[model samples]
Target chain A: MIARLLSAFALAGFSPLLWADALTGDVQRQPLNVSAIAMFVAFVALTLGITYWASKRNTSTSAFYTAGGSITGFQNGLAIAGDYMSAASFLGISALVFTSGYDGLIYSIGFLVGWPIILFLIAERLRNLGKYTFADVASYRLGQTQIRTLSACGSLVVVAFYLIAQMVGAGKLIELLFGLDYHVAVVLVGILMVLYVLFGGMLATTWVQIIKAVLLLSGASFMAIMVLKHVNFDISTLFSEAIKVHPKGEAIMSPGGLVKDPISAFSLGLALMFGTAGLPHILMRFFTVSDAKEARKSVFYATGFIGYFYILTFIIGFGAILLVSTNPDFKDATGALLGGNNMAAVHLANAVGGSVFLGFISAVAFATILAVVSGLTLAGASAVSHDLYASVFRKGRVNDKDEMRVSKITTVALGILAIGLGILFEKQNIAFMVGLAFSIAASCNFPVLLLSMYWKNLTTRGAMIGGWLGLITAVVLMVLGPTIWVQILGHEKAIYPYEYPALFSILIAFAGIWFFSVTDKSKAAAGERALFFPQFVRSQTGLGSSGATAH
Target chain B: MHDLAYKRIEQSPQFKELVAKREKFAWILSAIMLGLYVVFILLIAFQPQLLGARISPDSSVTWGIPMGVGLIVSAFVLTGIYVQRANGEFDRLNQAILDEVKQ
Candidate 1:
């Protein structure tokens, strides 16, 4: 499928690479790179083969949603790691470290610390209770229609914000790396991701993610090892060299101006840690595993892989500062990197292993974006089909075939929506976009999902109202906050000063849910409370849980 | 399993034991992780210089570097411990409870 698409583009005499160069006055026009195109095409062909194989096994709705719960612990681990390690993290964090050293480590640490919390609190129960989406678990003991409606809205909002970030990042990165036109890159990513989900479903999406994870980990490991070898495996030498070459000098060794005040730091930390727990795509991965045991094991492996990846990224960043920043070949006439700081890791790949490695890393980076967006599209589609369409609209009367059709249609819809938004927000500062996604997940999804699982008194009314409260508060405060209001809206001062909305919104959510649940004395609330024990038993023991279908 | 089986399991001593032990264990481990993370964030928030302090006079490496790396390693190690115990001891108890109730 992708081979045909690429050939069509090639035969059309596409010249967006030259067009982009003409628009940007400083950047020189890069001739179409043969090696990068070859490597990327090869990757797409291999994944297309996997999608073909997976489609054969994707007969049932269960299979479409979760590979028939057939994935093993280790494979799911790699997929989870792949899904979490987006191109944004790979290029964005390395770029951050190259620009401001210690603060990048802080971001990496914030990202990894969320994994253990998810494993400890959510993973096993989620596997035991949910079928395809987190809404399954969130609505397990409550009013299915109401709770599913709320959860679906939460999922779509997070997915949309996250998709925009990934799409824009993918377009810009591909434009820089492969010298493709920006719009062509965006369309290609959208169509290809839709293919992975629309035909192959979760089965193929997981494989694509797993393959990308292995490639990215190996590529980063090579870069980090070569970097260490240059300084003879001495950490101090690497640090000393980085300090000498970096413009900030010793200031880069400590915390800089990236995060200014305490409130902002705490809020951002809260969002990163808890936001990870609430991400719809991450939660959906648990259902791909057969049982609670595999679910737990996957998180363990994912944590190790992700932690190791971030550490490697830290090394890659410092190495880029030491090697790429000093090289005249990597720099433009303005003394900055040709494509900007985000290209530090790419340039370092060339510096260490020449253009061949650069091409390989670039291909892996593009694959990383494709894999992540595919997973996000799958999760968002599940929210629509499994939660809203099947459970809410049909009132659980929908057949397997109809549910599956809705999800496929949703996948294409989401794919087109992502591409449209990607182009629409091309000029926007997307740094705060991911932060907003995390903040919403932290504020709305995490609070509702957590309280539903643990708090027996959580009535449907309470969960629905409180969830909306958190969602609204987060979006409103974010608009009024510094990043959007003062920076994006051209306002003089932010009504809400903090950059992150997680701290305040999360508090309001929890307090609202508590107050509402305690005050409700209705019969429906009583019935909801009565259902908690059965739900709790199923959540803990996996009794009568959906098992892996026999192939 | 039916509602009766769920009631039986809920009342069983082994089920209660598993729930109490596992919940206590998870919460404790989670507290340790979250507590450490809160402290790390606090240090970054309140006293950035403390984290920025050099480890030794001879090296350019700062205290913040090891501390950040330690948090990452700590997250991985703590999850390892939880998984080890959950898959072994907790699973054993859960199986026993299920077996008893299945009869």
Candidate 2:
């Protein structure tokens, strides 16, 4: 699942640290048997049908930006879950377990722990404040031009890196599932994602996500149930069987020294915990609801779905260890996995239920990639149009029609950029790419957004300077760190020792924000400070908040 | 109407109490979760053997399985607690505060 989700991040997780199968052996396979391709085509047809239906019904900026703010809590929850349980979670985690064992379990838990915090601290307040992009929240009372510029840069950067990773993952998955060329698969993903956003907008995107989420959860449940049935439905039997088949035996059941030191572990934890809160794609979901209460409810349901899904990944991972490792048909001539071990979960579907189930899981994985990329595209386009164009260039005076038109243009541009980068990064280790995205999100966006909500003295200059610093620090450290520095760039030793830099970069942001804001004696700073009261009240209680105003 | 509502809610003791209580509860839950996760991570970094230790003398199941499961379950339970409080106690308090202001 992680292979398919995290490193399947391959946009969901670009974490190379966890992806052993992603590293070596059979990098490509001949193809999935024919049933998989047929099922995938059917899934695409269904999404295109949804796009055609949604395009007519949604005609205004409000519809394009937020689906008229009418999505129900349960549906949004499903969409959020769909948005999250990417191909990375399905393939990556299973592959990790297939190779390393219990290490996959720790990764899954870290990914989940962020949700309760989002529910408690940010979700309701965000729903109350933002109109479309999360940048709407940050620039509410600050220097609109400066803040939006910084936020657009931050959002675009995160989305670009993440989109590339997902596209690459999509390429790999399509090649395995549909017998397509890698470049063709990437272009197909890019073009389809653009069509979803350009035509159907948020309404289509949300429904696609909802459908994908349902399919993914049901597929995971079917696989887990099938896996358990083999062991008489006893978890102990499953784990023991996995241990016996695994070469590492009992050692696979514990932490395999991945969190070797406190600093690295703490930094990684900070990235995962705060990164989700900062992710532009995730934050923009709040605006698709009517009120703060609905937003809060969305989080509640999302927490349940996401938490449940992670637990399923653990079951599926251990199941792969037990089932996939022992099966000869899934193995290669050299006894290695046929299409890389990241195919473990997909292969397990065939092992448990045969080719038909394999076809089903493969389709679900393809759907997962489509749903996530569409979400990313919408968020990126909003940062370009709503934040950069409407808010900054036109000073929020751009009409609804004009803004939506610009967003569509931005979507096509972003889609092209994503395809190009996907091809370039194909040979690169993308596992750390997701981690880099999270680090910037945690450092740059999270701090600025949180402080804007809570701190009274937060000035525009402070936020811009601090945010850019955070952004630069994260990028510089990422480039010089062990992953990119030593491994990717072929340096002998890393200038930055750790893989994650959120801990240091977050402090830099806070310090820059605090130092500049507190020292400012200018009239604008005082005015900005005064504006925080009304902003605070509105954020807390939704007093005088804008309605969707779409229809 | 909205400005008047904000002024009234800001002044009312009920609103004050609600805000304080909600904020305090949220921070506490967050703190507890952070503590639990930090402890787990610390154990992994400092004493992996503890998580590696078997659940019992005979079982192949290690302590990490339950601990990992427990952490996952802990997130679900904590979310459930938050939802229950939000839907029941917090909502009731919030409604009363708003109603008082509306009157």
Candidate 3:
């Protein structure tokens, strides 16, 4: 029965390869067989179908950007999961777990924790004040032109960094799965992503995210269950077995043993935790819901779903560690590591469930990349079309159709740029790129959003100075920091030794905002003061009666 | 109706109490988060072994599970506090503000 089951699985898995074999003479040379191609085609069709339906419904700019601002709390919540769970969540987290063990789970935790912060402090306010971009909220009291310019700059930096990271991962995955050249894969992904975003906008992006989220979560859940079944559902025994296999005498339960130094570990933790709230692409999802209540509920649901998914990742990662240790083929001819760290999850799937699960997981990972890239593209488009063009350059003269066209064009341009960068940076660590993006976003954008909502005396000059200062500080620190200056460029004696730049950038931004606010001449206007410090103050004090008005 | 609205606003003392409670909770939550973050760093530095035993045949304990669990728990706690406050207090006060602004 075992043999038959294995054989049946192999047949199901290899069927795609069999189909590909009939099309080309070079099929044997290609990395991807017929099955991967079939899967890719199917995903493309589904994505395009979504785009078509969304386009048909998109009669106005609001529909194109915010789905007519009528999406249910549940749907928006699911879409948030879709937006956040990129290739990084699926492949990146799994790979981290495979290599680092317990340390990998730390990244997942940092990411999941940020949602509550958003839910509590940012989500409702973001929905209530903003229409499309977060700039809407920040600029409500400040002048439009000032906030628009600052937000555009911040948005562009974040979107570009994120886009490059996704593209690089996509290119590498395509090369591994299809035997295509890295450049070709990058270009192919670029074209498809651009088409999806340009035609459909937010509507297409939302649906893509939802679909990918479902696929990824279901696949991870299934694999985790199967893995647990292998050990007869005994988690305690699983851990004990893992401990026995390690050559190192260190206890598997401990944290300090995983790394050689203490500082690196702390820095890594800081990067993961702070980076979660700083990401622009993720924050943009909050504006899609209708009201603050819906936004809050959506976040609640997202937190629960995302939390469970992370648990499953832990299982998958540990499963890989065991499966790879047993499999001889995983190692290279020289007995060194082969196939790179990112492929750990893929190899694990092959070992446990044969090719069927392997192919399915691979397909899901590819879809994950596509969905994230589409969202990033939409963000970039909005930065240019909405904030920079309409609010800044053209001063709101651009009509709806013209504005939409600009957005589409920007998406295509960014898509191409991402493809180019992806091919160039294929050899670099994807996590590093993601970290850099988070650092930039956190430094440049986060402070502005926070202060605008809470601080009544915040001035336009302070915001501009703070935003620019954050941007410059983060870029400069990252350039001179150990990660880029020494490691990437191969400098033996770099100026800074730390790997992550997030903490420093955040501090600089905060300080800049404070300093500028105190020194600037602009004063809070009467109307603005009221908006900044609402009548809710008395209610918050807990000394007032239960009435509609607080004052 | 306007007079009634004004009278109600003038007479109500619950708003003050609610605001005080919400602010107190916010401060507590903020402190807790700060403490947890510090602990997270400390655990990373000096007590990596605090996570749990390994699950694989190898001796390495998977940190991702513990960290992921910590984040999820923190998120839930924070969300719970926010929901309690928002539903209990902010909703009514916020409506009042909107009404005042319109007038």
Candidate 4:
């Protein structure tokens, strides 16, 4: 999925990347597809019904932030898969494979590898130690103000970049799918996501995600089956046909210069792996389950579902290459697929099924964006309310009512902010935005959160300075790197040569935190180190962790 | 009450055993996952041609495709293995430790 950003940057100028199916920046209105619109309306109606039911139970901060820890592991697994298998991964990887075959596999592998790492390293401890946001765990025994403030900042920055990327993609994808104005589509997503988080909170959002994940997986599975059926269910025949028809021929079977150097490849790998572990929304999923056992199960199921989904994407991509690319009806006058390469899966849906299946797939794409953005908004709101307002400003003394109120207000504000930024960045190339989000997450948030749970010597001074160092380094280096400096800013050459900066910045964060922490002899550092054992005991055994709310 | 519970569990052998066993399992699994990933990425970086080589020379699919798919499958299986142990054995140990601490 992160490797989708690699081709996204390459396809940055004329073809919008990830979820966008539009061929160009010009958003032309096509004949309105009544079936797509009808399915979308049905999805909206059903989710709103669930939201109405969820409102009654969302009285406590716990309910608002994590559905009162009431979610089962299986359900949480589906929701986590939903949060991850974005429309971008579905269409973008397929498009990548439809064009350059094996590289897409590499990208999907990068995306799936992160889930297992999260399961083995982070998931159980996170569920046991944290309450609302990850800041809860980071600030457990450290200086509550400094650590919480740093975490909130890191979370917000990642959230802002990620939201903007999703928003822009949603606007463009909806514009092409439903034939709506770009601004209208962006505003529609903004309003619906805000409604989901503001009223339904985590319970409503979870159900919405589950529904979308099921729809997406089923739709993709059907398409893949149809593709295999065309080749008599022989995978070798399917591959042979794809290799024969693909323009790149045998070259598509190997790496196609996606990363020219070892450094860039390793940097990108580091970002995708650790970035998934650091994501606020993904990490927040652990708290929705009842305990560490359910949390572990959640990762187990999530890894399976996500890996299955990626395998399906690979089949669908090769299927698209074999079926859709050669079909004259699916191509434009210029021989390019109508709309863009990202429409490979969409056209394949129509080629395999019909107009009706096409409508279903289109609607599922819109639903995927909505589900994803709602989760991001909730994570962002939690950063502001639970982490910053409750823990930092109120010093953990605020009533739950006040904290929940702040969360709702922050949700509305974030919705408006997302809508505005979506429209503002409509024409700008946003491939780097998601990459920047991942970089900051891997470099800044992952290091601090990981160290706090595992390391006894992670003092506030070390975490604060090192965390900001990584955050700023990731951003500045991104701007000075190839993607932005040369491509976006019209520069001759990049000052920072690498496109991905996680390799450098993550090391700096770890070393900086280690050096600062070991050098510090402050009384505060001693107190924090002294508290690590109790934290360790609870994290290991769930001794005093929050349990699921009783009915 | 909570601090006392933590202190009691911290001193107990059951807690130590739980931590040691779980930590070992977790680290070993993490290393395998990360090691496999690093090897895959390094192959992509250093030896693209080797990964591009056909599995049987007559097959249309290259070695990279199965290796990639294999990595994905292995990831799922590894998590399954971890969850199976953690939820069954380690979890029982954890609960027993908690009970002793409560006593």
DockQ of each: 0.53, 0.46, 0.30, 0.61
Query: Candidate 1 chain A: minimum summed lDDT over ten consecutive residues — where?
Result: A13-22
Error (Å) of candidate 4 at residue A527 is 0.8
lDDT of 2: 0.82
lDDT of 3 by residue, B19-52 (tens): 4665676557756765675566555544444445
Ranking by lDDT: 4, 1, 2, 3
The sequence of per-residue lDDT tens digits that candidate 2 reaches over residues A1-551 is 22112221111122335632122222574565678778878888999999999999778878888998878778888888787788877788767767777777777777777888888889878888889989999988999999999999999999988887788878877777777888998999999999999999999999999999998899999988988898999878888888888899988988774433345555666777788899999999999988877787787788789878877877888888888888888888899887877888888998887989888888888889999999999999989999999989998787888988899999999989989998998778787767778889999999999999989999998998999999999999889889888988899999988777888998898999999889988999999998787777678777666665554
Q: What is the C-alpha lDDT of each candidate?
A: 0.85, 0.82, 0.66, 0.86
Tell me which of candidates 3 and 4 scores higher on lDDT. Answer: 4
Clash counts for all predictions:
0, 35, 47, 0
> Best candidate per TM-score, number?
4
Q: Which ten residues in a row have the lowest lDDT in candidate 4 chain A?
A: A12-21
> Considering DockQ, which of the candidate structures 2 and 3 is the better prediction for this target?
2
C-alpha lDDT (0 to 100) for residue B78 of candidate 2: 84
Candidate No. with top DockQ: 4
Clashing pairs in 4: none
Candidate 4 residues lying further than 4 Å off, grouped into runs, are A1-29, A486-492, B45-50, B56-59
**Alpha-carbon runs more than 4 Å astray in model 2:** A1-16, A19-26, A259-265, A486-488, A548-551, B1-5, B99-103
Tell me the lDDT of model 3 at A318.
Answer: 76
User: Per-residue lDDT for A392-465 in model 1, tens only?
Assistant: 99999989999988998999899989999999987777767777888899888999899888999999888888
- lDDT-superior candidate, 2 or 3: 2
Off by over 4 Å in 3: A1-30, A258-272, A334-338, A424-431, A487-492, A523-531, A534-551, B1-23, B40-71, B77-81, B84-103
Interface RMSD, per-candidate values to 1 decimal:
10.9, 5.2, 12.0, 4.0
